[model samples]
Target: MVIAIGFEGSANKLGIGIVDTKTNTILSNCRRTYVTPPGEGFLPRETAQHHKSKVLEVLKEALAEAKLSQDDIDVICYTKGPGMGGPLQVVAIVARTLALLWNKPIVGVNHCIGHIEMGRNVTKCENPTVLYVSGGNTQVIAYSRQRYRIFGETIDIAVGNCLDRFARVLKLSNDPSPGYNIEQMAKKGTKLMSIPYCVKGMDVSLSGILSYIESRAPGWLDQGECTPEDLCFSLQETVFAMLVETTERAMAHTGSNEVLIVGGVGCNLRLQEMMRLMCDERGATLYATDERYCIDNGAMIAVAGALEFETGQSTKLEDTFVTQRYRTDEVFISWRT
Candidate 1:
C-alpha cells in the first residue's frame, strides 16, 4: 500500500489525513479549529501559533485512528499557499521537517487545486465548471489546457468573510462558524428584505452588502420591523444569487454543462438549492460534496498531492516558501504527461 500523509493549516483549521494512494482511499482524517477571539481580525502570526500548538495533536489522533505507524507513510503532502503566511509556515515547517526526518518525498499542493480535486472526486464529473466559495476566496473556474482557469472572482471581500463580518455586526455566535449560524437563522426567517446584488462582468463585490447590512441593522432592530432570520435569508439570497450568476455565466462561456460547488460556503444547503435550481433550468447537472471534503481538510490535500506526485511534481527545499496570495494559475504542471 502506498501511504501518504497530508497536512493543512491554511486558515483557522488545522487538518491532517492519512490516505492509501494506491486505492485512492482515505484511511484517517482529523481536524481541529483554532481559537480566534471575537473583536480581533485574523492575525497571521497568532493563527500560525495556534496551528503550531495543535498540529501534532491532530496528526497523532489521525494516525492512531488509521492504525498506522509513521514508518508506514511513504510520502508527505501539504497545502502550499493562498493562505495566511503564519499559518502556512507552521504546516510547511512540519512538512519539511517530516520529509527530512523520514527521508520521504514531499509535495506542496495548491489549496484551491485541492478543493477542485476533492470536488471532482466526489462528483465524478469529467469536465465541470467549478464555483469555489469560501472565507478567503470566491471564484468561477474551469479546467482547460492542463490548468484551472479563473473566469470570475471576487474583487473585494470573500463571501464567507462578508458573512462573518455581518455576523459580528449582529453579535452572532462565532461557535460552529458564523456562516453556519447565519444559515440556521436564515432557515428560521420568512420575511425577505431587499439587499443590493452587485455583479460586474463575472466579478462580485461583497463589502458593499456587508456595509449596507451593518448600517440597516439598528433601524430594523429598534423598529422591531424585521427579524434577524429575515436579514439572514435576504443576505444569503443576495450573495448566493451573485455567485450563481457568475457560475452560470462561466458555464455558458466554457460550454460546460456540469457545475460543481466546492469550499466551505458550498456546505450551505440553501446555496446548493439555488445552484441546483439554476442548473435544472439550464438543463445541466449540479454536484456538491459533503462537509468532509467541502471544508478545508487533509484528505483533499493528500488526493491532490498524489496526483502531483504521479505527474512527477516535487518541491525543492529552497523553493518551499509560504505565500499569502498564491494564485492557482501560477503553479507549473510538472506531473502531467
Candidate 2:
C-alpha cells in the first residue's frame, strides 16, 4: 500500500500527518498551533520559528502514532504555496531535508487544494460547489475543465481574518480560537445591531465593514447602545449572510445542488446553519467537516499530496519552493478525470 507523510506549516498551525493512498484514510494526524494572546496577532517570523522548533517533535509523534517507520512511507508531501512566506519556507526546507534523508519522492500541494480534497474525502461530496473559508482565504469554487474555478471571493481581507481582527478589537480569548469564542458569545446576543453588509457582485469587501464596526463598537458599548454580544451577533449574521448569498449564486451559476464548506471558519455552527437554510430553500444539500478536519491540519495536506503522488505527481528538489500568493485556479487537478 502506498503511504505518504505530509507536513503543513502554512501559518500559525503546524501539522504532521500520514495517510494511506489506496484506502484514502488518515493513519495519523498531529498538529500544533502558535496562538497569540488576546488582542494580538501572530507574526510570520515568530510563527516560522515556532514551527521550525516543533516540526521534528511533531513528526516523531506522528510516526509513532501511525506505528510506521519512515521507510514505510512512499512519499513526502508539504504545503507549497498561498501561505505566510516564513512559515511556508520553514516547512519547505524541512520537507526537502526529509525527502533527501529518507530517500523518498517529494510532492508539493496547494494549501487550498488540501482543504478541498480533505473536505471531499470525509464528506463524500462529489461535484459540489465548495465555499473555502479561512483566516487567509475566502473563495467560492467549483471544479470545471481540469481546475477549481473560483467564482467569488473576498476582495480585501479573508473572512476569518476579518473575524479575528474584530475579535481582537473586543479582547476576546484566543485559547481555542477567536472565532469559536465569538460564536459562543454571539449565541447570547439578543439584539441584532446594524452593521455594514458589503457584497459587490461575486466578491465581498470586509475591510470596510470591519472598520465601520470597530469604529461604532466602542461608542455603542460606552453609550449602552449595544453590548459586545450584540455586536458579535450582528457581525456574524451580516458576514455569514453575505457568504451564503455568494455561495448560492455560485451554485446557481454552476447548476449544482451540493455546497461544501471547508477551512477553519467552516466549523462555525452559525455559518453552517445559515448555509443550511439557503440550501434547504433551494432544494440542495450542505456539507462541512467537523472542527478537527475543518481547521488547518496536516490531514488535509496528506490527503491532497497522496492523491497527487498516486497520480504520478512529484516535485524535484529544485522546485520545492514555497510561495505566498499562489491562486486557487493556478493548480491543475490531475488526480481527477
Residue-level lDDT of model 2, residues 1-337, one tens digit each, is 5888889999889999999977877999999999899999999999999998999999999999999998899999999989999999999999999899989999999999999999999999999999999999999999999899999999999999999999999999888899998999999998998888999999999999999999989999999988899999999999999999999999999999999999999999999999999999999999998988998888888899988887778998999999999899999999887
Deviation of model 1 at 201, angstroms: 0.8
Q: In terms of TM-score, how similar is model 2 to the real structure?
A: 0.99
Q: Tens digits of per-residue lDDT for model 1 on 1-337?
A: 3688899989988999988867878898899876555533567888888899998899889899989988998779999988988899999999999899888999888999989887887678878999999999999998877778899999999998999888887777767788998999999989888778899998999998889989998799789989988899899999999999999999889888999999999999999999999999999999998888899999888888877887767788777777888897776655442
Give the Å shift of residue 82 in candidate 2. 0.6
Model 1 deviation from native, Cα RMSD in Å: 1.5
Compared with the true structure, all predictions reach lDDT values of 0.87, 0.93
The residue-level lDDT of candidate 2 at 273 comes to 97
Error (Å) of candidate 2 at residue 149 is: 0.2
True-vs-predicted CA distance for residue 105, candidate 1, Å:
0.9
